[model samples]
Target chain A: MRILALPPEAPPMLRRLTSGLRRAALGAGALGVAAFAPQIARAATVHVTVAYYSAATGPYFKQMAAAFEKTHPGTTIKIDVVNWNNLQQVLQTDVSGGVPPDISIIGTRWLLSFVKDGIAEPLDSFMTPAFRNRFIPVFLKPGEIGGKVYGLPIAASARALFYNKTLLTKAGFPNGPKTWNDVIAAAKKIKAMGAYGFGLQGKEIETDVYWYYALWSYGGHLMGANGKVAFDSAAGVKALTLYKTMVDQGLTEPGVTNYTREDLQNLFKQGRLGMVITAPFLIGQIAKEAPKLAYGIVPVPTGTVQSTYAVTDSIVMFKASKVKKQAWQFLDFLFTKDNRVLFNKNEGFLPTTRAVAADPYFQDNKQLQVFVNLLPKAHFAPVIRGWENVAKAVIDAVQSVYLGKAQPAAALKTAATSADRALAQ
Target chain B: MTASARRAFAPRMLIAPSFVLALFIIAYPFFDIARMSVYHVSRFGILGGFAGLANFRRIFADPVFIATVWRTLVWTGAVVSGTILVSLPVSLVLNENFHGQGLARTLVMLPWSVSLTMSAIVWLWSFDANHGMINATLQSIGVLRQPVQWMARASTAFPIEILVGILVSVPFVVTIFLGGLSSIPSDIYEAARIDGAGRVQQFWRLTLPLLRPFISLAVVLNVIYVFNSFPIIWVMTQGGPAEGTQILVTYLYELAFRLGRPGEAAAVSLAMLAILMVFTTIYVRMQMRSAEP
Candidate 1:
């Protein structure tokens, strides 16, 4: 009867009352849930932070984060971009401060130390059997410590020799050197042609560590089965002697001792160096910054074995992270074939998954494929707990040897002694 | 309360906030660093079990640490002496009532206003081996055919750093000396002239002695600043060209941050702090001696 004779304002009031009643019913339902479980009363958005490198790779990560948020409506993902020089310190400080990013791209060489410190959470518990089998085996090795997986490789890079094609041709070697002896001969030829035969980072850790890539290729072992410094072995001494001879022969730049990655890259771009052993990730940067250089990427020259240093970037969860589940969700999403293709495409990273590497995007890329081919032959750095100290000692000794202040045998001995002492610490 | 009590109470209140500030700003960090220095903290800065004197022993045994200490001393000495000697004349010129004295004074102090890192970058570009402005200018003037690789060579790298340090620090030194010069009444110079004292004699006997306090203050400041300098040396060479440019601060930064040897870095920093305390003690003594009747 009231509806039959309803005033115009009464209908509006009735509509409002009905909507308010519905909201109150929903609120009571939510309160019922809260009363049943107190934890639900404090339910909050789980914020996960993921970090990556590569100025070009930041946007892809953001897109991945967006997709992850879309898939899980209530969760959020944060992406942090770090430059190479500061990444190690930033990660160290965060983990050490007990407030690490939920997931981060840690250097493969840095994983052992992080794992040893108990800062990296073992991902084995989270990874399904199918997920574990997706990546290349070498890509899996860096994140493995004591047979426990602490990280999962997302993007990878490998070191190889880059040569100036025109310079190599002028030096009577149309193709890049395939062996150490040939490299030296070609370097000397280039030196005679008024160009630096080679570019090497003789000053910093690059001297000791990068040269080890060459040494291992020549059947050298930095640490023997006993795990002591074995750089004084026959192969180690030969590797060091060859390096010193190149410097003495004026086949390398006089200022080689001062070169870092930036310096080496610039010199190569300027046609001052015939060849440099650098990572495949540099190709994209070179193409962008100096597009005119006629260059070739080949396998790192061999001594007796075909080997190269493989660097992997892995997404590691922090031990203290509260949003680890969300972090894993984001990590799993990142390695899916489609996302991996986008990530590896713009970033110049080799996809960790063999299937992703075989995608049409990477299959036809000749320069990129050479690096892809080397994936099987790649070896990771030593996974010792105190590898940083050992690496620094070895670098200092190499510097001493290169500067002619100490003999190679003595320097390597000192390095090994110090390294052993550090390992003990 | 009586008027005297009220005044005393107000003064105490005025100083109370500062005391609280001192506890938070100075005492807290001092005690923290001291605590960290003695502990064998892991690279992650978490507390590992204590090992007495282990870190100090490790630091002493490190050749790079020893080299860095010597380098820090050399850098401090160079910056202090270079800053004072150069700025002394600059302040003298500025103190004279010459034309454009205001502009000259401002220009002399301009570098002090720029941050150290910015100054380092500017100087680095000027000193670059190839395509640097300095080299370009020198080449245009037919000074040399080949550009000098100023930062690449071991011998030139530290010298270049020292030169830049001197350039940045001289402005502050000159300004402080100018203040000292101004406080000495003009009548003193007039009296010396009237007494038939030559300009050289007056400067050595009168002006030098009068400026001693300022010189001591500037030396202490310069030494502390130059010894603690990291950005300039780090940006230019990063203790490189075979660690030729390494000073104490850069060495500590590399060891702690780059090499992940916090224990060694902390030990070296404590040793440096000990050295600087000695410098500060000596400075206080000099100040006391100068202030004596």
Candidate 2:
């Protein structure tokens, strides 16, 4: 259409118009490709859904997901942080609904149930000997149900006696209690100083576990060789009586039946409680929430044996998950030395891996050292079906005894029956 | 289309969406629950074939379930009756010509506007043995020698739970009663007065009979709501201190969600539904009777 030939370099406006058209065409082409890029990438991307409980540590999960995505390129990790109280229900519901997440961080006690239900994927194929050896054996043992590894311990905690150092000193004890009797005596002394001597969690959720710390200390077990509840033994009665005596003597806080583990921790953090038995998570919380309050951690006072509750949350892959390999990758990423150390340090959980535990970050800390040393002596709750219901029965019995509604021997006997019933169910 | 055809199809077309919605939302789930009640559903919700009436038999045989049923009945009766009693007086006061009457009516409705969980939490704080306002005030005034652990003991917990239920429920009942009170013509009261009726007589003879429909409605609705109420007991006591306050709904929740026994939970739900249906039938009968001349 060039009726009139122009110079090689045309008018400024015309040059600009040609260049603009060229740029627009290029931009359109680029935009078209850009628009389809995500779709194409998404087709290749492996979507892994990770469900865990830690409302407080949600941001850390997002960070971990982002880090995983960045390194893995065409992969995505979706994180769901369910409330700890509702994790089991939600996970079960999700599993039943056939839309379960690819990976789930579940209570260690649930591993057997999940395995028995056939929803949990065996991770032995993914976990090599080197990788298996990386984890602390005790923490890893719960994840193994019947010689098949269904889960990996992602976070763990060992219950220990947390004493308010200032309160203990104020009550004429410079250090923490050395024995159960010392605890009672110090508690009485602290109560005289206008603070609760012992903060007992008599409520449902962890009440049974708290009772176990005492029960196991007295060399009692939840089940015997025949797999029946053996908690009605003399040791169990003694354990219940210990708590009952403390409450009756006004050494523990009033309304012990209403106190949750967290509530007791809060009371202790406020310097109003002389001693509490809880996990190492409280150390981080107390350091952050109550920095001015000095505290000490020790193994739970021995009755006939030295024992504490060792609780672990494990990560397992769902059998229905399509991206098992990618899920394993993320799981492996989570337990890597640096990530494990950082995550545990931030989340106030004990490291599941030996490498992380051996890190100076955990070694040099005196408060964490007590819990770390107690790990070997820690006892997990019986990993039996209907343990939750059994625990509820024990909680009821303990609460009744604490409230003086029943005698320890009778309550323990009844609780034992109830536990047996629950086990049989 | 012909005009006749269009007219004939119009109503059905207009109602089709809601009908389908009701089918999916209400009928489907209800039938599913009914089916679940007859089967042995596992923890994974796998139906383990027909269990016949075993679930129902087991629940009925269980002493705890029997206790829960009785508790549920007691909870419904006490809460509904308490609501009516408290609301009737407040609604009457609100209906009268008085200073701050509008403000009083609004204030009376405040608790109704708050969600049950929020109110339960507020009440939880108030009933805290050591730091709750009720305990603190009672102790300060020497009414309590020590801070009584209200929710920690079954005896005290049950009453406080009922009281909290009434607290949350009374506002709704008051508003309903107020609506009923306003609808009654003043002329009837005037006529009663002209016939030598005192204020008490006028209220007793005229106000009550005329408000019968509303009172029945309030009672029926309150019965359902209080029967199905979960939060007040859950947040306050968690049906605890030995499952003392565990009613039908909380027990169902524990059975289904906590214990992972959907079949048993569904049985409990069906039992609850049957009991509620009886009340519903009575309410409908009363409504029909009231509607007639």
Q: What tens-digit string does per-residue lDDT give for candidate 2 at A89-203?
A: 8776766655666888888877777887788999998988999999888988888888988878888888889898888887777779878988988988898888899888988
CA shift of A92, model 2, Å = 2.5
Best by DockQ: 2
lDDT value, residue A189 of candidate 1: 90
Clash count list over all predictions: 0, 0
List the global CA lDDT of all models: 0.79, 0.82
Pairs clashing within candidate 2: none
lDDT of 1 at B49: 72
Which window of 10 residues has the lowest lDDT sum in candidate 2 chain B? Answer: B55-64
lDDT, model 2, position A412: 85
- What's the lDDT for residue B77 in model 2? 93
C-alpha RMSD over true interface residues, each candidate: 2.2, 1.4
Runs with alpha carbons beyond 4 Å of true place in candidate 1: A1-52, A203-205, B1-17, B137-145, B290-293
